[model samples]
Target chain A: MDEETAKMIADKGAWLCLQPFLDDEDAIPFPEGTPQRTKQLAMVAGTENAYRLAKKHNIKTAFGTDVLFDAELAAKQGKQLAKLQRWYTPFEVLKMATFNNAQLLKFCGPRDPYPGELGVIKEGALADMILVDGNPLQNLDLIIDPTKNFVLIMKDGKIYKNTIQFK
Target chain B: MLFLYGLLGRAQETAEKNTILIINATVFDGQNEKMQEGMSILVEGNKIAKIAKTINIPQTAQVVNAQGKVLMPGLIDAHAHPMFAGISQQAGLTSQDGYLNLVAAKTAEKFLMQGFTSLREASGNSISLKCAIDQGLYLGPRIYPTGPMISQTSGHADYRPSTSIPYDPNATLSYIERSGHALIADGVPEIIKGVRSVLRMGATQVKLGAGGGVASIYDPLDVTQYTFEELKAAVDVAETWNTYVMVHAYTPKAIQTSLGPG
Candidate 1:
């Protein structure tokens, strides 16, 4: 997207949802030089530009891994977020994937089923949190493998996995 | 010193009656650059009641000593397709609905274990899966379902066998059409009906295919699909239902013409 278009998006209060996809993670297998393969590569190429434009234009951006129809590739969801570190700090990627993305879900408006605060860790916000085995901001790659790094997963104040050792 | 327990297993018993106190972790809080070190959080029922360095909780509360790990908001995928993300393109087109659902069900759990707490489904039929997760029959991320993507005939989502093209619109629904993966609609009336049909099936929003795409069998990357009236009709139906439309478009003509800067 051009700077003018990016500015229009911000002025209109629209969001640009982006995914960090590389060639290996293509949702479908596309052999080299095929029209589909070329198109797929071109789409991924636009991701970086859109992200940078959104930041430059102060547009609200959302993060997602649009890895579909490939369970093996889908497992690498966290890597998509971690790769964003190429364009942003770990903290920035973390925030965009969390609290910032939740803000966009609110656009569902009256159709929103899970009403109440989401995405933030604050008083009165929904208790959706994770306990990482290491500091994500310091080492974002730890997220690339959530099963090992996310020792605990809690949703709506309910603990689903708790493997932390006690003192 | 604080101690916690684990392995309540896959079935969530319900919101913990006892408050959960998580101590000794660095908190990200989802809105800051600087992480708060050595902090704690108290979850009462389903809300974070407090976050501090010291919290005096009742003896019965669940105390999780984080051991200085990172405590942050669960991840969210603003765009996802839980129902279609796992199976292969061929499997999605030919697999039985029942089998496909089971695969998607497993996919949902995998995504959750990956630390995604919420997902805004960009397309596909996940209404029943969302209901199942909500009822505690299974575990998965919160899904904001958008239902099947609507497309114009030979547009982005059209994946019918080549011989089947130009078939009578009045004929029995195609197997793929019956599968609810996508709908082939044309003109303003069909567009409105398509949008309303998905909404009837509990879609929170509607997705319209506004241009060509590579993954599908037909159309080049730059061809714009739906006309302005058909696209507007879809938007009108969604707006009347208090929702919105997300078009799958790739070019300026496809996007700007339909979804104006207004």
Candidate 2:
């Protein structure tokens, strides 16, 4: 492992995007003895290895989920993020998803449809953001169930959700 | 009618008050590593006005006491089929447009209530549904609609009966196809035309069935669909419209074939 090369890539603002939650062992529909099962196992190993390498080299990381075909699974995206708790600290995972991912999106350059700054809050940054009910840094699992934990959601300065009405 | 109108007008007047102050909350703020405890957020109109431990709360502004609750961003579903309602393919052949739209609307509301603020419609006809939501005629999440799933004959998107002949004028279009849910195109010209038609209908992206599926009657899971030339035509049309194509493929061969043309 080329530690210098990994550090160079990190310095160049490259992000190691990982989706460990996509490696759902139980979701493999194939029979246990089938070749498809073997392939699924290999995929799980690959995902774990990628995460390990990124962490070992202190590489910049980003979070995403490649959910498709199943609506039930699609709604479990937050659970997928929580699954990362097996490998990372809650704060590290949150930073990877928010700060690191936003930095990577900037690489889109001209193709970036959203011109405003994202994934952060500042005086002039984009108003797209969220507010959770629990301290996620202490308990990452709180993010797994958004309906119960997410008390407020604001996008582009508008409050789309507010469970506790002040009126 | 006059009395009802007056009540609604008053309700709208109150709902239009956009200043909101959320206080005594633990703020995630999306990007920050540390959570700010006992913070206050002031939203003026649709934008966040201020976030501090203290802010001058306007008398007219709505004030929400967070009580140390966690506040975060709404979730986003990257791949969602809001139009699908779990009916059998054969049953879909008999379903009407009204029934399908109602089902889609219900699904959309479910998504919104579940805290999903945005959805990327994967492989269904949802442009009209998206429009209805955007126009405030329906309550749902923001949608990035893919008009329809394009597939080759006997591909994953091919939900037609086995007895139906290919491109036969005597045989009417399948309910799914007629309802703008999927299109079966065999050749490059047909693929290009189908892609363009969907793009014209305000599709932000194109979804093509580039592989077989378990639910599909004819195509086996291993079989690859859509030749390189055919896939290229769809890609070309999508690129012309400043969008991209997403192919539904499980097998490596199908994925590789789809990647070949792009």
Specify the highest-TM-score model's number. Answer: 1
lDDT of 1 by residue, B1-262 (tens): 1222344521243333448889898898888978888887998888898987898975657888987689999999988989878988878888888888898889989988899989998877788889999888888998999878898778877877887867876777777778787889999998889999999988888888887776877878778888888888888898999888877766656756555712
Can you give the lDDT of residue A41 in candidate 1?
79
Q: What is the lDDT of residue A67 in candidate 1?
A: 71
Tens digit of per-residue lDDT, candidate 2, span A1-167? 13444455455544444566444642524457665455556555556656776688777766655443344654566777788888898877776666555665444344343455665555455555566666888898887787888776665555667776664
Q: Which pairs clash in model 1?
A: A69-B85
Measured by TM-score, how close is model 1 to the native structure?
0.92
Tens digit per residue, CA lDDT, model 2, B1-262: 9999999998897677777787887777666666677888777765566889998888768788888677654455555677763333344456787877886787777666655555567677888998898776887766767778898888877877787854677777887888898888889999989999887777777889887664455676678898999999998988887777777665546656766666
**Cα error, candidate 1, residue B56 (Å):** 1.9
Error of 2 at A161 (Å): 4.7
